[model samples]
Target chain A: MKNWSEKTLKRIWKGILVAVLLLIVFTFSPWVLVKGKIDPILFSMPYHLWVSILSTILLVVFTGIGGMVFYHLKLKTDPNANL
Target chain B: MTQYLLLIGVLYVGVLFFLSLRSRKEIKTSSDFMLGGAKIGLILGFMTFAATLFSTFTLMGMPDFSRNNGVGAWIFLAFSDAVMVFFILWFGFYLRKRVGSESFGGMSRLLQNCYQNKGVGYLYFIAVFLFLVPYVAIQIRGVAIFLIEAFPDFIPVWAWSVFIVVVMLLYSELGGLKAIIYADFMQGTLLLIVVWLVAMNCLDNVGGWSALFEQTANTQPDLLSPPGPKGLLSPQFLIASCIAIAMIPVTQPQLSTRLVIMKDYAALRRMAVAVGFFAILIIIPTVIIGLYGALQYADASTSSFLGSVLLREQHPAIAAVTIIGLFAAAMSTSDSQLFAMGNEFRGLIGSKGENNLTPIRIAIFVFAAAALLFSLVSSNELVLLARLSFSGTGIMGPMIILGILAKKPQGSFMIGLSAVALVIFIVSQLGWIPQQIFNMRLDLLLMILLSLGALINYYVKK
Candidate 1:
């Protein structure tokens, strides 16, 4: 199969880029946005669990979409694609 | 402990033998034996996957965890089932559509092609076999101990071991994957019925869910919580669990075979939803059984009951439920392991050799014997053994994901990840690393590092 089409490649790269952005924002950001005050979301669930669950969902969804795009690209390029 | 159950065990073995002999005519070629020609339908696929996943470990160990920790144990069950579902939906379809190999070892060859390294392929093969044998043997010993308890006066532990070994070996040797799947389907159904009955009985005895929850909350609140037991599980553990789940869709042998067996991606996606639901349903009864024991026997030891009972020379009806449940769990896992190992041996050795069946048979025996030996010597907890094996496979998870995403993975990337994994493994084994390192989950660390390692290597090489 030839390389992925520009559009499909761009779609995959976009998904990965979004995931990375979310990771940086959520993982590294402070628990309380306004200094000494508490964060409402952190109280409901542990900060780690909240971050983990959110990141996991984001990673699985983005990677899945990326995988699907690449798969379709391969199929489009290959004359002998069985699927 | 129960005469009726003893009769059932004998009948179960006889039926398995009959099925084994019956399926021999359909096993002329290696493919037929190894993968049933990859023609498994939805029903067989679902049943086999359910049976293989819900082994004696879940039956015995899950409850033990619940008894000690509480709902946190359910997280383990949930993550495992989730991983299986993800695998069915994502990688299973593609792997089947592309490589279409029968065993995990065959998939390793595909990964080797991506990374361009034979050493990595061999490491994957060896790692799978080394860990799988002990896992299989644990099941064998579980079955043996169950029989010994059921027929205390008549059957010895060794005899029961021999009987289970012979029965599993005969069916696997003769009927191949098809026979194992059929047996697993029946066992899975029986286990489901029996587990639910036991759960209902336990609930009745414990005064229902409210009482059960109250008792567990008072005694072990941490078990019910997310982190669990102060230091045992942390955010790192959950992170590892998710990474492990993502890897499951790509790595596990039983789940991977489901991909190759499906008719198409649609079938696989449908199967994923079904399998996920079934797995969740199966785990509920297991959690209940474990909680029941925790409530009733306030101080029952966490380890195997056989030695404790032998010291006391008495057996209770509750113990019988535990025994039967343990038997179900062990059989489910052993059946899957046997099928996976048989297929792996056939794929690797049968491709090159003239006397294929002999090598396959030898591999089966060697695997069984080694596992039995290890089980005999090791006094460690069964769950600990299972966890160690899980960690061993954690290293390969990132590489498998990269294989799917990257068309041309760098050799240095593969070697670096393998080297890091090897170092972690050796450090853990040698006691050089702090205990917290072992306690703290490494699955997430390995996956993130390996992914970054591959990405960086790709760019550098380009």
Candidate 2:
């Protein structure tokens, strides 16, 4: 039981690590600048504007899903696990 | 309109008073008073957390920030908040596992437990109070001026400020954290309903979302892009804002306590997701109102633009409810911080204070009075002041992360460095030093310095 709990905990941490890296790379990467464009209006908003709003929507969604899955599935496996 | 607004405002206060009066009886001990006995369920927890997180800043600051800074403002808050909710997952689990049903004394007490040095705990307390008191002061001031602008004839501005402090204190003093939490739920719901209605009206005036953007671009193209026309939302500024805001859940004592006080892990996780959803729904409307301001109220002062967008343009009825909503937002957040300060005092003095509720309440009153005095003296730039609060607290973020994650004592070295970092941040805030250090925003620079120092401190201890 302890071994299984350890594996589940390990996987959750790995998932968190990946999510953090993805956020840092896309949102704060100095190499990628998604601003200054105003001509290409996507669905009435500027490309940059739509992109910013969409990206935030995406981040919020991912956080919700990630939090739900981790807690409901892995963390539930062992109440005693030091998550 | 004024008469109707006055009626609704009184009704709202009456509702808040009833809630506080009923909940006050639950306070049998200091822990019950400070944390609601850690019995907060999922929905209530989510509502209070959302209410606390979304404050007058969203209603007043964001519309102004977007009007002044353009699309980059979304990156600053909406995205930053989404990221911060994820921090709750790890921070909550670790801290709860360590504390293990131990009534939370205060954040400083938690750090003391982790470091085993009361000095390090005191260092953390002093640094956070230095920054957070100003934070509480500015929130009070921000809404006081808003109310003043909303009602110019009634009592002077300073009187409005005093009223805000008194209302916040009474709300918390009556029922403690639970009262504040219930009030938050009411405030959060009112803010969401009223802001969205206001946004729809603004959008209708400017012609739907697409037309709003088209009009804005035609009139003010810079309002649609980065650095804005005012050159405010540069990449560095946006990135620093993201870091500062994202660190909030990890560093803010009021917020961290919410995580621990949840009924269980499942409740915490669900509450976090709810907060994230609330963040999106609450923020998107502010963007619309800001775009409306950009199109209609360009070249207007922030106060006049807010008065126009939130009041004159909407139905007088909505304009009135919004006043009540703004009052709710400011009180919800202000009371939480004030109460947290009181709790921190109780913890710092050592948690044997099972029967020391009166002294703690007295301490909270002193702090509340101090915040009121500071509010009268502070500036009126809402977003800038809010940003300063975030960054000042953000500088301490890594020390907290290190404390929670550390398996052993990392010693007094990091504590010494933390004081230095705090001083650098304070001096920069006071205009005594360059706002930017080495071409990066000073807050972000400080984060990097402390992070590296934490890494070294870890290895040295090993």
Candidate 3:
């Protein structure tokens, strides 16, 4: 068995960083600004309202999916032989 | 209707009493009392976490917020909660790694070990204590105000508040966190079921989702956007809220303790994801209820709007069940917090050893009583008061983050810096200092400075 290499750890941090930045952009940036400004009705709701509702659902699903995969990979690649 | 409320209330209280009795066997030692013997499996772990986080704030405070602020409430809570849960996966792992599996009284004790300075523990507890009191008070206050509104002819506000604290003290002093966890599971399920039932009815009454949104958009489209109609949920405010709430798992001892008590990282991971979905599930119904208010009670007062939606809008029988659910939500959240304070009080009063559990129990009762009194005197702006609590505790987040991520002893510089920042925050709140610097919120500014201070200390010392 091998220890968790620094390269692997760095990759994990990089993945987290990207996820954080993308979340920030989608939530706080012009993406929300432009879309949230559009009051056009969509699916019985305004565009901004739909964005808030749909975007939240998307975030939950994305995180749930992302976390499950992360757990799987980490378990498979755990450095501890007995784990 | 009155009889129904009493029956359901009695049944719920009976169940809690039974759970407390059952848990007595598991809580012989201090560790067992504090962390449920560190054996909470997936369902209990997830529900307890969700229940503690979702609170009267969700059951009562949020629907009122969304009713007034419009759809921005989603951004305020749901989005931030989603982000928080994602962060939880990594943060939970880091916290468990540094703190170990033993229940070390509370968060302050863990920090005391990490920084090797007792002052850090004191300062951290002081920061959290200052925030947790009003935070718990609002939970009591939120439900108390609503209970009076629901049963106005009966209980006065303060009486309702005191009743809850007494109930909280009873179960908590009996079985401690173990009792609170089981109680939380019951409360969480009640909260989810009752809110959804009321929300579906609200939807049906408001002519469903399409009519509710169409009515709000046609009558007041401003209710659907950034600042909302009341101008409370601005982009900057929402952004600051996201930051404060996202830091909750780090700064809030009740939640951090839950992280340590989970069976393992696998349980924690599943708990985190479950919480994310729970956040959506919980907040979605509140938004629907809020929109229903927009349609039916557009110009009503907050109390009136909440009463109509939570009580008057439902059948009398369902309204009775909903009241019990609201009481359960507030009690579950407050019990965790007051117990966390007790844990902190224990650690602060005796860091050298664990010889006096009696003092902690007394402290818990005192804390619960204090929250009841504070509920009488506190502001009625539930979400704002809650955000204040978040930001106050959040100023201490960088130190905890630094501790969790650091590979070696991080020293006391971060501690001193955070202590000074916490002092500034309290002073600012008391009107002794400007609440904002450079046109930015003082709490947000403190967070940036604290994080920078942590980085500098890390680089220089290690």
Candidate 4:
């Protein structure tokens, strides 16, 4: 059962990694950057700036989530793992 | 202001010496000196990592970068850092696991063992030394310039630079890595506090967040958007920067050593997450401060603008603390890089150098002296020089990743590829070759080719 759970976590991590790469690529894309578009501001920030901030925050959240899953998987697979 | 600066500066130096002396008692072996005994917990691990990664570049360069380039500086640094911390989770695990069975040394030594070739280690050392010296120098140069601007005719910039290098060397040589880590914790906290206080003051002066952006729009709407006023933050440039910055953990020895020294995998992972949040927290203030610079000192010279805003405009007490904070910022990062390079040299020289800290100590002094000389001649383009350092060392990302992740380690070709790419990048930076080829940046293209090369090597060997 532990092995099975570990496998599931590993799969989730792989998925998260893919999602993160996509998010990063999209954040750097023309759609998000949209040169000279300062409209649709939030809290007085320009479009690209706010979007970039949001993207950074989202990436941090993903990092937190990814780290938790990674920790559990490592604990399971390498029981004698050097700390 | 001078009195406050003198008081706080003396106190700060006293604390640094106390920490160094205390750490000296813990040093019984080379590992204790070089790797801080490799038993770091989450808080110290994250703070040292954060402090080392975000140095004078973040504190001094970012505000000026944003003031000139606009909000895209966020994407340039903070966004890049967010990706970097996540990369750490993956890379750090593989690295720690690989080194788990072996006695850990610097990355140069580890790569030598990984590839069973001395050339791999030599290539890495040369690449890192060529790039990191200037990176370390700029830390000295940035603070030295700021101090000169803050106090005219008090001391020459070169003298200030020498003073910083001497103080940093004295403590680091005495206490070793443990002392550096403790100092980093203090510097990191001080950095966070100082930047936010200054940013809050800047924000208040410019009204709130909304009004600040409005005034910036009026001053230079280009500062409010992408490509910026100078078009320096174009998508291609930012994308390239993101790749370079994200590769920092994989390529930069100072950070890579921190990854290896964490007490456990759990601590390493937690450190990564904490660093991510820390990156966001540290960078946001620089943005506010940058936009503030835009409102007031947009056209002033870099030193002039920073002095007026970071020193002259603030309360005397606050200004004094800011000066100390900047000084601490420079030392926290420079000392680590200098020490890491010394450790790398020790790694290459074998156990003779390791068993006796004397040789390593001398190497550290030599490296510091070289950096001081470089600092004297280096430009004031702090952010760009830093990025170039990242990009130059970053070209080794594929070589290092292959070294770390390979199962059988038959990727000797990467050494030559990285060297060739490093040379070409340097030549282009020197303007012997065009910076862009077929409308793509040369550095970006080289990175793509190297990654592909590593991928092909991995599959073929597997």
Q: Evaluated with lDDT, which candidate comes out highest?
A: 4
Tens digits of per-residue lDDT for model 1, B218-295: 665454454455444444554455455446446556556656765555445555655666666667776676666666
Query: Which prediction has more favorable DockQ, 1 or 4?
Result: 4
Task: For residues B343-452, write the lDDT of model 3, one tens digit per residue.
Answer: 77777776432655777887778777777778899977888889999999999999998877777779878888888898898999999999778888787788878989
The segments of candidate 4 whose C-alpha lies over 4 angstroms from its true place after superposition are A1-4, A78-83
Give TM-scores for every candidate, taking all chains together and pairing residue i with residue i. 0.79, 0.95, 0.94, 0.98
iRMSD in angstroms, per model: 7.8, 2.2, 3.2, 1.5
- Among the numbered candidates, top DockQ falls to 4
Q: Kindly report the docking quality category of candidate 3.
A: acceptable
**What lDDT is obtained when candidate 3 is compared to the true structure?**
0.81
Q: Cα lDDT for residue B321, model 2?
A: 92
Query: Tens-digit lDDT track for model 4 on B1-462?
Result: 989999998999999999999999999998789888878899999999999998999999999999999999999999999999999988998899778866577899999988889999988898898889889998999999999988899999999999999988888988989999999999999999999999998988889888898998887898888888898998899999999999999888999999988888888888888998898999999999999998899789999988988898899999999999999999999999988998898898998876888888888888899899999999998999999999999999998899878878765788888889999999999999999999999989999999999998888888
- Model 4 clashing residue pairs (backbone): A83-B263, A83-B264
Q: What tens digits encode model 2's per-residue C-alpha lDDT throughout B96-163?
A: 77667677888888888888888877777777677677778877887887777787788887998888
* TM-score of the second chain for every model: 0.87, 0.97, 0.97, 0.99
Worst 10 residues of 2 chain B by lDDT: B351-360
Categorize the docking of model 1: incorrect
RMSD (Cα, Å) for all candidates, in order, is 6.3, 2.3, 2.7, 1.4
For candidate 1, what's the TM-score of chain A, rounded to 2 decimals?
Answer: 0.49
**Which parts of model 2 have CA positions greater than 4 angstroms off?**
A1-16, A30-32, A72-83
DockQ of each: 0.09, 0.53, 0.42, 0.73
